[model samples]
Target: MKSNNSLTPSYFQFTVFADYGPLRYLFFSLCLLIYMIIISANVVIILTVCLENSLHQPMYIFICCLSLNSLYGSAGFFPRFLMDLLSDTHFISRPFCFIQMCIIQLYLGHELTLLTVMAYDRLVAICQPLHYHSKMTFRTMLLLLMFVVFYPVCILIYFFYLASSLPLCGNKLHRIFCTCWTVIELSCVDTTVIRIASQFCIVISIFVPLSFVLYTYLRILLVCRRSSSDFRGKALQTCLPHIVTFGNFCISLCCEFSMSQYDADEVNSSAIITLSLEFLIIPPIINPLVYGLNLPQIRKVIFRFLRINQT
Candidate 1:
């Protein structure tokens, strides 16, 4: 049992993956399989969307963006994670840790921003159907892309700046990888400013996308009231998957906030488990599942492709 103070540059530490014997291996294995599914499914989406030009509308473009973002995030976390899971050497170089944190945050932040953008795209499509094409043109897409890249870049810079200020004390990162707040906590120096900055970032980043989703849905509901019954049902069905994905994220955020307060020792296995669920697993898994289960076009293509492959 290592205390927070016991961490040193030479020591290897990892977040509590599992405390029970078989459960650790089983959980890690499960996560590995889920990660693979995430990668494979997202890759399919990207390729299918790009090659099938019929899918190259504003909606599909946003889907491609979301898939790519998920890939970027999963790629950052999963490889190093597999290594850490299998090996006793959990210690990572400080620079490497910073790199991990930056890449992860950049991708994850972009995912959040893209979701908001997508929600807006949906809003335009549903609420101002005639203007959707004009409103969400290639130029508009490019502008949104710029913002997506820009905000995440700013987040990365801020993370590095605040991370650099933190004293290494001992370079043991408790997590499988260098998470932003996790790294921030290890600093022995005054972390009040950094902590405050991070909290502000979290609030803004979390709420903006959340608000976008909510507002889009609210308008969508109003539009539905005016729409024909069939149109209303179809529209609601299309939006259901996004709503579920967003809901999962909201749950994860709440878990993260709660877990942030508990000491590692004080944090029960169930508590930690709850915190890990959505962040590590949901986006990758949910993206594919939502698309496959809810979107008939994608599922038809997937099935057709699979049948062709089997032949």
Candidate 2:
């Protein structure tokens, strides 16, 4: 058995899917609807930000980046997911599983960094109105965007390097998609080193951005309180959508994290699936809607784009 532990399996079995009977088609239809909506909504936001010169500002640009990340993440998950919904076999090849894991982790990492960047942008715009433009220069925006993207990829390269070197004793993944932790759990060797490294990375990946974002919001709220009602309203208008998106992202991730960290054998399988997919399903759909409907600048431009196309 120890000798076999050194060998990587060709594929992994996903034990999450059940016999939904004929309802599998229903599940497929609903998920397909969701995937389409995610694609359409995110594409609109990305296009809106690109075409509108006014929305080329830092905030809207960050929002576009968020939408782009959503698309990236969804593409990684939903195609495989939608297929698994109707398929009898749910096995994924080792290489493709790693690819999916990379996409998802990068998506998660990019999201946190991007949100933190958005918070910093709002903090500067609201708290230090005079220095906002000078501080958030075009060059700075590009740099920040680059950081949001490659920081996670770099971290994952190191982490996956460690993960890939490990020899696996099992091929069963308890969830629909691959995550680093879950895959690591299948290793036959002691995972103490990997576990500690992953925990450290998790803190850096998840908590650091969240803490900074919270600090920024706290500062903005304090600033809003000191200002007049009109100023408060304007600040809220700009920040509300971001706050909602941030909150939603956190909640979804918490649910997914809880499921991943614990043994969920006794829990209902339907509930398990919901918890697993919640992180991927909710945020992508909600992000574009929140920013599209709540932010006046985006809402106005989206409407104008629609009206122009109607003519």
Candidate 3:
């Protein structure tokens, strides 16, 4: 048998749907279109929030953060994915694979943190209206924004550090992109420490925020039930979009995790590819649309801009 060091590869091959043949072009075209839309829509949201003074409030600031996160996350995945679609041989350099994994993980972590902050923002706005302004002050918002962006990056730096120390036994990645778990599985050494750390990170990064979102929404629902219809309508108008976005994102993430954990040999390759890409593809597209269409201020700003550009 070859030595483990010798067996380790310098590059990883993506074997997901590599045999699609002619259909690869079709998939490439579709993905490129969606990616363009994601970029365009998210840019609109960021620019709209920046240009419109009326949207300088805490809620809209949160929306802007969400849009930025969408762009950040999509940037990590779509470009490489599109490139892979057009390539006959889908391989990534070992260093680039680790870079990609870190970026993708950062995106996921930032997204959940931002959403959790948004949920808290909504909770304050609806449940403690008078305190909303005081609680979500400019200083507070700035701090939260910093935390959202940096917290994930800090965690992922350590994650990559741990991953980098391990000696690999193999280098063939089964999925379209590199993930920490997949890379960990390729290690020749024991991964007990890495596994324990990953579980802890997941709980702190994903589950805690998810729980907060659920709790905040539940409280909002209870409060809405007792309030006047006008108040209820106002609450619904603001909170409904957040709820929808949250639900869609959570479901997509669940699908991603489930597919990642599933028995790859038993599952269809196409299905695995679809599930793997869902969280990356769906949320970025859905989020900007949901916010832009549902929020009247944003909708008006978008229309006004469109009309100006048309003239």
Pairs that collide in candidate 3 are: none
The 0-to-1 C-alpha lDDT of every candidate, in the order given, reads: 0.74, 0.88, 0.85
* Model 1 lDDT tens row, 1-311: 55644443533356554444555577679878988899888888888778776778877778888888888888877887776666645667666777777877787678777777778887888888899888899999999988988987876687778666655565544445677677667766777877777778778878877887898999999999988999898887778877887777677666776676554567775656555656867877788678666877777777777898999
Candidate 2 weakest lDDT stretch, 10 residues: 258-267
lDDT of 3 by residue, 1-311 (tens): 66755455778888775667899899999999999999999999999999999999888988988988888878888889999988888889888888889888888888878888889898999999998888999999999899888988887777677667677787777888988877776788787777777767765766878889999989999999999999999999998888888888788777776665654566688887888778888889889999999989899999999999999
The pairs that clash in candidate 2 are none
lDDT (tens digit, per residue) of candidate 2 on 102-184 = 99988988987788889999999999999999999999999999998888888788767765767888888888888887788
Evaluation by TM-score, superior candidate among 2 and 3: 2
Q: TM-score of every model?
A: 0.87, 0.95, 0.93
Best by lDDT: 2
**CA lDDT for candidate 3:** 0.85
| Clash statistics: count for each candidate | 1, 0, 0
Tell me the spans in candidate 2 whose CA falls farther than 4 Å from its real position. 1-6, 264-268
Which segments of candidate 3 are over 4 A away from where they belong? Answer: 1-8
